[model samples]
Target: MAEQLRLVVPLHGEQVSNMQQLVSVMLVDDEIMALNNLKNLIDWEEAGYTIVASETNPRNALESFHKYRPQIVLVDIMMPVMNGLELSREIFALNIPVRILILTSYKDFLYAKEAVEIGISNYLVKHEINEESLILELGKLKYEIQNTETNDRYLRQRLIRHLIGGLLPPENLEIGIKNKYLDFKIGSLAFLFAKIDTSYPILKEISVVAKSHSNFIWDIFNLANDTEYMDAIRLNPDEAVFVIYFKEEELKETVREIASKTCKKMQERFQQDYEHTISIVPIIVDNKNQNIRNIYSIAENSFNYSVYMGKNIIIDYESIPTAVNSSFKEVSVILNELESDFVKRDSESLKNRLNIIFTLLGKPPWNPEDVQNTCDRLVFTLVKFRNKNSIQDNPSKIEISNLFNLNSIRKWFESEFISSVENAVTIDALRYSRIVRKILVILHHEYNVDLSIEEIADRIHLSAVYIRKRFKNEIGITILGYLTKIRMEKAIELLSTGEYKVFEVAELVGYSSSQYFSKVFKKYSGLRPLDYTSGV
Candidate 1:
């Protein structure tokens, strides 16, 4: 014999009545008088129906749907705003397993059959319902639905717990988990959090691409390449977390490689404009362990560690050693060398110093923070140099105030680093170098023209003196000297090709006087421009 399910009664009592425990129901009718009459005449609470919400206004049905999300909807066939049948159809589209009971007074069997086709649970004629009959009908519906108060209550509590768990403050995470009204079993898991350092515009592009398909969850999981238990969830608008379950014996280095590759792929695929950090916490917890109060704290600390150590790093809780001092020492050494080069105004030495730092770090060629800091310091130094020295005292000179504001170096560094971090290993250093390279290219390209150093600086959004110093530090030549060399070279090329007269060539290279152009060209090349070009 099969086990019979227990039922509860509906009555004015503290405990649920016998018939009430078996089912939950909702009631809806367009006629206010009729709806209230039914509510007063029938003891619905006794019939195992939980009237979550009763609305005389059908317009509020959608709001009720969001609020209650009930298992059953008793609706009138005709109503205003949202008609009963139309509302029923729309509600069914939500894919909720709702048992809808339709009430109608007209003798329309055809309409009743249509309701059945539309998945209505039952059709009742309004005139046929009396106080006793209603009780009997509701009791039958209760038994049919087989609602369980205990199970329903537990599920609701679990959903609430899940949502609250993710949103809790860092300090309150574990406390929130512990105070959950529902019971859940947790297992040992590995957690990682990440922040994509991108501008709002770039982030929006990523967002659009991320939602282009339903396979995002699966795609990210596959990207992790973890065959073991894997779960991923978006923690916030700009961050995500991946939870992985693996035995301690698993190769941990492989996890770091996977994470780095994933970050690279995201950058390449989305053309991301900034560096991002993937913080890792590889931990082991039993299935029954539910404490997560300090989860965010641990994760946040790990995140800051990653940022401090530089981005794109994977730090495992299981692998940290006692020799943290050695790591700090190496970083300090690099910083000291960079600071020394900046103070000395040694352009070639600074470049060589940065190269050494990159080699020591064993990161990619594109990585090194030295060059970035050097660019910043060089810019500032030039601005100070110009403020103290008058350029008119030496016409063959450049002025810092004419070009860029050295004080805005921080903002400039941020924009450059955040815009092309993907192609860089040492993101900060690469950004500074790249910007310096761009300025040099522009200067060289327009060397023979009547170019204003300040204009070029303004074009690239840097100060003239700062640009000159930074260019000298990176390219091993002062900006004016380089430009002079380029114009002299062009003058020689024109003379050699016999493209124009000596006077014309002189004017072409930005000198109004041919004698002056010849004097400058000979001084730079150790020969007269015409003689160097003639070679006879």
Candidate 2:
């Protein structure tokens, strides 16, 4: 027979002698049996630092520490009442340099180090320590605690500074395209524009998909550090714009494949989760050195073409017919109406005319492909008109210039005419009014000093007379009146802050004298500055 075997049971109970009052001992732990064993193992008097009381509850440790002001504390790493680290932090807050010895399992060394960093003096490995080792470590820590000072008062201030330093604001497309740290070289370059069929909520789903599948798209496109791709999707509630960068010419097929796959995956993944369809426009980047804005235009035009041609189809600009047979007479009539409506600020009428033009171009039942073809013709025709006007403005009698070349016309249209159209439309009457609002803000913020009207005009890229007229028409006030309003508003804010006297506030916000500023403020707000702040 095998020798009679005795299995060792973990020590789970504390033993204390009746001579406990001579040196009080405090043990904090979540495991009742373990806490009891620790109490039994340590001889309080031999260690020099006496634990005043023993507690299993961590929340009670703070009150006990404050009450006893104990010279030593033993805390467990894993506790139910409160974690040892949290309890140590609270104890440190009391401005007491008590020797905190951590009672943790041998497996808790990582946590023990962290505990020590938070002001714990010694980390005692439980189930391995006996009376001799506990007293030896505690005797050593007692000397350190006697000379230590608690600097825990500045903890929150340091934490807040670190948190603030970690925060960063988001960057938009301008920054993304210009970021030098980001690598943008890929094997081949291609652009995909994804348009969502529903409103903003619906459009947000595709944006989520785009971000999720970004790595898949990059891998499928075979992008590398020296050869990478960049993509951006400007999302509206109803529509979205997507632009991609890859190796020119070579990656066209992969781009189309990835784009189509992405759109398909997005549609299927989101259809059950959301109601939306994502359509894609695939365009090849022919010139990497060309302006990014030009690449943007190509992608944008291709996307618009996608909407016109059909939904969810990849259309290449090079494959499309350069010349389409259409009646320019009808197109010219439509353009005249559009030009007049734009000048008159009749957006409703312009939208109606545009709809009619699209309809006429589509013929019956409205094939979008035909409409796209017709719009291309319209753009070409308008570009030709602009070049003819330019030639007339700068007449050259040189016979060599008369030579006909289609390629030259195409380049001129892309490089010059398209940009001109963008600049013209972007600052039209609608956008002009927004610019005036921004100008008003600038004026109010800087009214006390001399601001050059020419400089302001140059900033907005409009003539002085044009600025004055447009500002007046849109705002129902001259630049001076608007500036005065802003200055007066600032004066009221300053008076309310109570940091300055009424007279000082007036001068600070740009008025030379308090009396004049008060009179103007009264006229605008139905009360003088002093009376207003005084509740009169």
Candidate 3:
């Protein structure tokens, strides 16, 4: 059985009845007497309906409808300012799931056909709206409304598909609006594009985790005071976009942080649930392309920065200098160096070579699609090579497919090459080098943890003295010195972000004492943390 969603809000008169759940209803008519009669005409609570709003003025109908968002609306066909059809049109514009009934006299009932044309589904002549007929229609409409809610999931998916494919013109929003599929609106808008990676297919998980993830995203941003409405549109597999309707002032100041935090929370939750992180590249996109191709094009280009900035990270398109996509020939050089570094157990050399490749791709005057396709090809080749060698750690197809950015390729290469070098390291003591390599991996993953050579030696069944000597011989640095270098590098990187204070950065780099971290940082970088920030 499909699970049902129960949404409850306190009604104005909660104690009026013993019913815990009731379908909300609304009545709209030009005559005050008619409105009152409709409200009292049926034993609504007995029929599982509650008249939340009754308005004699059509001008006030829309306001009441919006505020209550009632499931059923009974509106008169002819009225001043706005007739039932006009009011219904606006009410339907919100794309809310509502069953609208047209209330008309015999003369006005001629246009009842028109009400159906305007998306009204039920109609009843004024004299005929008694308890029996009202009961029958409400019961029938209630069933249809519940069925519509049942199918709402697919509708939302269709809405997202339309948004990602590019929304039609405002005039064309009618068909979608008439079906009550989505609230079509235009205003101060900012967009965020997300790149997701998961082993499970999105379709299989659409009902639960996917919806929960989407809900979590909105919950994160809606907490902000300056935003009125926030929504997300899932793009093609592994891609999604968040749309924020912000106050004009917030457009410049808050959008970037909201986008960043959303990216962070999403990656963290997936890592928690799936045991794998979905690296996201989020950027504020240009709304100027609402009708043109550039709307998604600019966002796609910015997301491609995952190539340079790395995974499980956020890069704002506006903050970074634009990069150019590389040509096929230029990318081929990167491939050559990759092979050489793999053969030589040269991780550092590979890092530099990959850095150069990404830097070239990060520059301007390049096609975003071409570069993304190139990265995809590169990741595919690397994964195929890893599988061919029977390496234990091959990236899942989902991960490889999500490698549509530069930083993604860089991270994958560093990791795979580390394993490659480990499998075939040509040092005099093979087991010793492997032990040292294991230590390096720990340092990389747990840079935030307070760690020492003794602790690591115990973790991997080696003596502290042996680990120290072998690490120095194989990697050319004392364990302490290496740890200090890694910590200092992290400190500098965090300080450069300008987001954290010296003490916070110190803690983040595994230093309990800001003073000691600063002392070590100064020795390594030739400057204090604050001083380094000024230069950056």
Candidate 4:
């Protein structure tokens, strides 16, 4: 029965309830019958505890104890070849918190005194150990362990905050190290700052999953290969910071390699699971004289460069250029030329000029503020041209200012700003020809129908090849691509009303398979149709 029970027990760290985790127990006795009796003494799982290991030899018990690291150990006091007290001494020397209950036959006061002096939690006289008595004792130990864990977690979080904020004093650091709250050694320290890319369209919705992402990323870095110790703290809803301690100074390159691998894993997991991306900046502080604040500041500064470097990559601090460029006059010249292109209604020239400006801005030595100011100036120039030309449609100031990165800014310039300008331009018969207008009408009105490019071309008495080329040239996207975009937009509207199920939305969006529709929806919007409806 003891062997069978051990086989069926839940492993340590398994969840017992939403708010409670199973406490693990290890049984150590020199007698096989006594060990089996202890295992069968009570229903351990019912009491929220699991018997991970049971041993008849004290030496094997010590080995199993280290391997399982159970919170509670029940050992017989009168064991041969390394008695229970000697084993307890060895366990205590490891400095890990564990409750030891001595099972003894002795009734002497001296025996109990020795057990207490050796940090034994409680002793159960072997003959008097009933199921009720054992359960009561285990209850007290579980409560104490839970309290200690809660306090330890709180202290660890507080200390990490202090370290990151540069407020931890030398004395506090000493005390934290001594008390085992901070897991730092005489080793080289570095930091990895991670943040979800803010330029994602549904950032507000993404914030709902930020805490879970933070925990997942923390686990990734904490379990990083070759890392001696790691601790992480969430700096905000969108960002987290991790401090990694390496035991050897020569592992600097090892740190970068591990960080790179970790970041790649993070990218793969996030993209595959969440359909999202994140930016990680790894900073290795070479100067031991600097404090934690200086190290964090360096990582933070490196993280800011993600705007130029783009998303889903590791930005190494040492790789950044040290030189600064302040060529606002050259940027002004490009802005003036962009305004000329806009006035000429040359959409192609406008695209080329915007690309030049963004490419120049992406080069090193420009700060975010410099980019922002340049972007603001460009918005002003376009808005001025629109106002002078009496064009009603223009990108709002808020939309222009809210762009967070170079990629997002460039996308906005093309899609929102330039597209609006193109639409407002006086339609030349040679440009926005009658054939494209008819196709646009068909797409907007009959989007839910199974209309293919060939069928539409046949309906309009044109060849499919000619229409496909004409559509792409005029609309900047293929007919099918535009159709998908329209369908997805309509689906969003339908889902926002909270009146349609996913399948219904799928059908209304011209998709035959709801499963395929969901996949496409997630890829298009970074959320499932259900998540959008549920406001997640």
User: What is the lDDT for 478 in model 2?
Assistant: 86
The lDDT-based order of candidates, best leading, equals 4, 3, 2, 1
lDDT of every predicted structure (CA atoms): 0.52, 0.52, 0.63, 0.71
What does the lDDT read for residue 498 in candidate 1? 51
CA lDDT, candidate 1, residue 242: 55
Could you give candidate 4's per-residue lDDT for residues 1-536 as a string of tens digits?
Answer: 21111111111233324112578899999899988999899999888898888998888988877666689999998999998899999888766669999989867788789989989998889999999999999999999987876665445556767767877534644475435634343345556787776552322232334435555554443333212134556777667776655543346676566556656666666666556677887776556555667767887787767677776778877877643757665666677557545644567877888888888877777666567667677766666666754667744444543455786677677664566556555543445788997787688667778998999999999999999999999989999988888789768866875667899889876899999999988988999888899999
For model 3, the superposed segments whose C-alpha errors exceed 4 Å read 1-24, 29-52, 56-58, 66-71, 75-99, 102-136, 142-193, 198-237, 240-269, 279-289, 313-315, 324-536
Q: After superposition, how far is residue 197 of candidate 2 from its true place, in Å?
A: 3.4
Per-residue lDDT over 1-536 for candidate 2, one digit per residue giving the tens place of the 0 to 100 score: 01111111111122223332122346788778887787667656655545567777888877777665566788887887578888989989765446687877776667867876887877877877988888778767655543331222122223222322342222432353233212333334445555543211111223333333333322322211111123333333333333334332244556566555544544454433333344555555555454444554554555543433543354565554333455444645665555434323344655566666655654422333444344465454444444533322222232222112222222332333334443344444344567785576467446766566777888888898988888899878988787777677556655654556888877766777778888888899999888878868
**Poorest 10 consecutive residues of model 3 by lDDT?**
1-10
Expressed as tens digits, the lDDT of each residue in 108-196 for candidate 3 is 54586687787898778888777898899989988887675545434544565565577643454447543443433332455556655
Global fold similarity of model 4 (TM-score): 0.56
Candidate 4 global CA lDDT score: 0.71
In angstroms, give how far residue 44 of model 1 lies from its true place. Answer: 36
Q: Which stretches of candidate 4 lie over 4 Å from their true place?
A: 1-20, 169-179, 183-196, 200-234, 240-291, 308-333, 343-345, 360-374, 383-405, 415-536
RMSD of each: 23.3, 30.0, 17.4, 19.6
Each candidate: how many clashes? 26, 15, 11, 0
Best by TM-score: 4
Q: How many angstroms is residue 237 displaced in model 1 relative to the true structure, after the best TM-score fit?
A: 2.9
Error of 1 at 32 (Å): 54
